[model samples]
Target chain A: MARQVAQRDDLLPVLAETFREHGYEGASLSLIATATGLGKGSLYHFFPGGKAEMVEAVLAEIEAWFEARVFAPLRQDDDPAAAIAQMFGTVTDYFRSGRRVCLVGALSLSDARDRFGQALRRYFALWVEALTEALTRVGHPPEGATALSEDIVGGIQGAVVLARALDRPETFERILVCLRERARAA
Target chain B: MARQVAQRDDLLPVLAETFREHGYEGASLSLIATATGLGKGSLYHFFPGGKAEMVEAVLAEIEAWFEARVFAPLRQDDDPAAAIAQMFGTVTDYFRSGRRVCLVGALSLSDARDRFGQALRRYFALWVEALTEALTRVGHPPEGATALSEDIVGGIQGAVVLARALDRPETFERILVCLRERARAA
Candidate 1:
């Protein structure tokens, strides 16, 4: 039998998915290893800090994704509205049309909250900061822009819960539409 | 020494808090027992089905809370807006001003989702249904009312996440206001 070595980058999304599907505490290392078709030892090789490190890596990856797809486009010199529209489409696809839940939200619970609280807080803060900047660029008042930015991110998280609960993909879509309306409100 | 016997009703909230503070997987019998100042054996006496039963009990309690405060009031003929407003106030207090996370959202992840998925989904659906009925009475279109109600519930869940992550109680308050606006929309 040939042994396959997994790269660190390849393991992050798998770990994120595991965390999303199972709350952070529920997703055991063995479960993650099984998901990736890798051994627990191999997972350790990639994440030296164990589950904690794996969580940080997954969160960082998610942040990077948002930065590239959503925040960056919002700052482009082209039509801000157009950029936001495209970003919304990508968000829908990334969340699998809102069928998937947020790993960040799941991991933020319980002991995981104590372990990853600062990073989680920073992640949300950065989102609000990034979105606020973009909204300001589009002529929204700073205070309202900041508030709306927070609401948009928070609202999307809520949409994930509702989507799953109701078994409706359209609920997630409606949230994005509401977000777009706020972005364009200014 | 006087022994304090905890009632089943008292134990439910403590267990709910344990689950909230720690994900369901992490909130062991020992921890839950400690929270209520009861022995592990005593916990079992109250919850014969073990962790699963405890979860069912907690969920049942939450449902009862909503039935009494939100749904029932919505169905009342006199001023649904007034009832909803009162319900919102109770909800605000129930969440401790957003300093708390949703046990439903936490438990709905991974395996617990499989165990309690239907219950969780039904809980959310029931909220949407009740809100839709009230909104229609207040003159909102049925479809729009349904969609908005889902958003309001989902948005609150997400807001809980954001508030925890951001360490901002105001974030939760802001979400309530957004919900209020949607509720009042005709």
Candidate 2:
């Protein structure tokens, strides 16, 4: 049972990538099974609730990632600049240098919008709050920090879209630089 | 004959919305045909090369929009800020306050990345160049302006992604504010 649990954890990342590449509506069960090297029966065994449950798990995983790689560092750090820079590094790494499309962008606009909408909103809200705290520590006033942090969250997402479309990492990199610039400004 | 041409022109907006909502790969011919209220035969009749040609026409329509609304005004006006603000107004109206998804974002990471890459790149490049020129005229150094303009394009695209996912217009509105800030900074 432990071994099976371990294998299922391994499959989650694969499934995440598959969903990222193809939105929930587009990522058929057959495609998920093929990508994970698991037959439909095996996939069902791992995700008994099927695709919807699998998607919720993936979103949960992403939220956990932000907690570990982003908010944790920001909350624990004294240097907001370093914290923000490290967060961007984490972001750049996660998106695979802009090659992997953001599932949030796709699924939010997909037919599942109503179902996944609140979770998506929560994801952005959490990121903005963490970043806002960091910005506030860097001497920005409360209002400006909140607002700027919101822009940063949206801006990073926007950069990912552009970088993906242009098939380049420069835009993503430049935006990261802008994020780092905020830290330097302090 | 003229009536048919006019009817096809009317279909462009509907097709554009469908493509914008569902990326190239996801926007199946049947969905598009249904959206346009046309049968497959009629869709093919309008677009002989089918979806690819339809996408090309949509991109072309976007290009014409830039010429009339963005490029034409920037080229004609001396005040870069006014020109840019007007352009943002046009964009705000077009994207329906950030409810619409961008096709470039959908297609770039799509399977048709290779087939439609050039046109997508051109779409961004032209927008960047136009903004760069406007910035240059307002005293932004040429090199810095080009880079910033590119960032703006990517940033706006990213903001749209966030706004769509969160189902909020504020993020999109904020990014446009940032764009306006740059214009004013010059």
Candidate 3:
């Protein structure tokens, strides 16, 4: 019984990685089964609604992770600079310094956005809003804070795309450094 | 006949749009046929190598357009600032002020990158290289030029993702305005 629960919990990361690497449309049931080391019956037992349920659970886990580790700190931390700095570090580690794709960002670019629009929208929106608040606390005017927040958030997403396109993880790291400098100077 | 040639040329944009809206893996031949108003037999006649051939043709057309309009201008234009400004204008128009997805950028984030790695890499690498050259002419040191080039290019791609994710095209346009301001300052 305990093993069953652990197996279900462990399946989320594998599913996330499968979607990240293969994308929603590209990650077929056979592929998911292969990645999770589960048969179709086991998968359906765990996720009756199938792939959509699997993706929903993955998105939920991702959102919960960011909210606890990243967003809440940006909004609630006493030190805005520290919060922003931590965001950079956490983000770097989260994306594996560019070796990993942003599953949410990748989904946003694909037609899967249509299937998960609200969750996708909320993820990025909460991020920008939280960072904008942090930037405002950092002494920028409201308008500048908002614009800069968008740039920083959008810039990170773009850097991921460029890094993957170039097959160069260092590109992602370099851009993060530059963005860090800009955020610090701000 | 001339009509057939024109149909082939016109088919490129439709195929690009289809792929842009529905990713490479999601875009089936039936979808392509519906988008291009061409039957499978005729599509095969034009692209004997199948969907791969069609995508290759689209990539070639996109590369050619950027070469003539964006990249060549960045590389050869006498006025660096003017060239940069013109690039902003052309890119905005090319992306339809954030309403259009960058097909290459989208593909880079998908599993399709594995299949079209060379063309995908060349498309972005050239854009960054040409932009870096233009930024160098604007007086930035080589390293700074390259970093800024990546930031600008990546930022644009990210903005598209954000715009689509948030269902707000203005987010994209707003980011572009900020990027343009940064480029001018550089």
Per-prediction DockQ comes to: 0.69, 0.56, 0.85
User: What is the lDDT ranking, best to worst?
Assistant: 3, 1, 2
Q: Name the candidate, 1 or 3, with the larger DockQ value.
A: 3
Worst 10 residues of 3 chain A by lDDT: A1-10
TM-score of 1: 0.93
Give the Cα lDDT of each candidate. 0.79, 0.76, 0.89
Put down candidate 2 lDDT per residue, B32-73, tens digits, no spaces.
978987888778888899989998999888878787889867
Compared with the true structure, what per-residue lDDT tens digits does model 1 show for residues B92-144? Answer: 88887778777877665445877888788878888878878888888888768
Worst 10 residues of 1 chain B by lDDT: B105-114
lDDT, candidate 3, A10-40, per-residue tens: 8999999999999999999999999987889
Which digits, one per residue and each the tens of the lDDT, describe model 2 over residues A148-170? 88677877777776776677787
Q: Give the clash total for candidate 2.
A: 1
Error of 2 at B137 (Å): 0.5
Worst 10 residues of 2 chain B by lDDT: B1-10
What residue runs in model 3 are displaced by over 4 Å at the alpha carbon? A1-7, B1-7
Identify the runs in model 1 with alpha carbons over 4 angstroms from their true place.
Answer: A1-3, B1-4
- Give the winner by DockQ: 1 or 2: 1
Q: Kindly report the docking quality category of candidate 1.
A: medium
Candidate 3 residue pairs in clash (backbone atoms < 3 Å): none
lDDT of 3 by residue, B106-185 (tens): 88888888888899999999999999999888887886888889999999999988888888988898999888877764
